[model samples]
Target: MSAWLPIAPCTPRDCAAHEGARRAPLAAAALLLAGCALTLLGVACVPGVRLLAPSLRDRLVRGWAYAVVRAFGVRLRVTGCQVEPGRPATGELVVANHVSWLDIPLVAAVLPARMVAKSEIRHWPVFGRFAALGGTLFIERDRLRALPGAVHALAGALAAGSRVAVFPQGSTWCGRDGGGSFRPAAFQAAVDAGAAVRPLRIAYRTPERAPAGAAAFVGDDPLAASLWRVVTAAGLTAEIRVLPPIPAGGEPDRRALALAAQSAVASDSANRPAASVHH
Candidate 1:
């Protein structure tokens, strides 16, 4: 899998830290149960949600996403929402730094888009059903042969004015410190459709705002263990900073476009916040 799938050097032992505040076992279990219930509810509502108007559906999805994150007892802080005075809300590619499983709902809360997930997620229990219901595009990242088809699908969606979210890093990293680069192949879709690239940076922190490494879902970490640690981490905050959108049409090629996006996401001084939300 390392041949095609991007690999990160971070392991649970080296990357995860137990520095965050802890919650009682009972509280953690309660929070996890609440989160699970909310997810199931979201899944059940998908068919009804699909019948609603686009604008209304977007709002409902965002609200549901917010609730999911909140139910897990994670405080969300958002900065730099990508909005213009009269820009069309669709036809843009939403890209972000991947940190944990929490990132899916977190981004959806901000900008509800057709998520680009791995094929493995399609076989998971509740999340898989929800993902399929919500129109997630599953990519076989380990297989090089599937690359073109994925890109073509992404381009088709963008051409039809759909906002699609993808993590070009291919796999999850420990944190943003030293992870995989944004692969250029995905950028080709944006270039083909003349879509803009919207980049966002997501980070996990303690109540004191220190880096919450315990939240990292790095190498050799089981999903249940990561999920448990996330629920039990008291006052664990996810700070999402949205960077400026790049016009992919302006770039010479996908490589340059990818580099520009990677640079924007990695930079700390990208700019001031257009708006801030503490949810």
Candidate 2:
């Protein structure tokens, strides 16, 4: 386990004062459209680019994510030990707490790993197409029969030296209660592939550096409403803390691996100052 270092805490007063301030909707819309265009263009070019340079497609996907983060005006700050991009020699699994839809771009902006998302996301208008082009692995959460196959596919990807990112909590949380308990099934992929599990903590803050509840997408929150809130917020920042990787060899089974990873994340979350607000 790594020591938890306290970053400067954002004040509630600062957050309250900035609540009334809003960015222009027209500007946000324009930026959103521009981002979508760039992403779609990148996706369209991937097939051709992949033929010439295999890695360039992944790089383009990452660039698209970076553009989305910037267009939304969200500041990203990463903490803790940094891990290099691409697959590691022993394989790697990134497990993180989920708070909002912003987590996707925020993670992609830094880490170059194929994300494991819910199957329904593949049908979500334009975003679905972008996700598929980015090489996301979709898991059918509602069908229990589909889980074993999904796990097997994930394991195969890892064994082939691909870094895979998963939100073991299965659903988004309000950044409260440590973002819910992590489900153990995903850990099996790590075990089967002999991969190390990396636990990451994601926190959102306002421009004033205060915890940002407005950025969280929880409950039955409409996607448009959440997007409007983030774009209109005075300022939003995503703070990502990457903890030490838990080696798979020592874990006796998937259950043990899952518990260890969850414990590490929970402990890190509890010790760190509550710097992000949730919806």
Give per-model TM-scores: 0.93, 0.82
lDDT of each: 0.83, 0.72
Backbone clashes in model 1, listed as residue pairs: none
What lDDT tens digits, residue by residue, belong to model 1 across residues 1-279?
532278878888888766767999999999999998998899999989999988889889989999999999888888876453222554899888778888999988887889998899999987798799898988888888998898999999998898999988877787748468988888999998889999888888887767788678888799888888889999998888878889757689999998899988888664344455545
Residue pair clashes in candidate 2: 211-277, 212-277
Q: What is the RMSD of candidate 1?
A: 2.1
TM-score for candidate 2, residues paired by index: 0.82
What tens digits encode model 2's per-residue C-alpha lDDT throughout 1-279?
001111212222222223635778787677567755665676677556556543565666566777777777676777766556544775689998877888887777666788998788899877688678667899887777787888898999888888889888776665635656678888998898888899888878766666677667765667776777777775677877777889878689988988888888778453464443221
Best by the TM-score measure: 1
Error of 2 at 221 (Å): 1.6
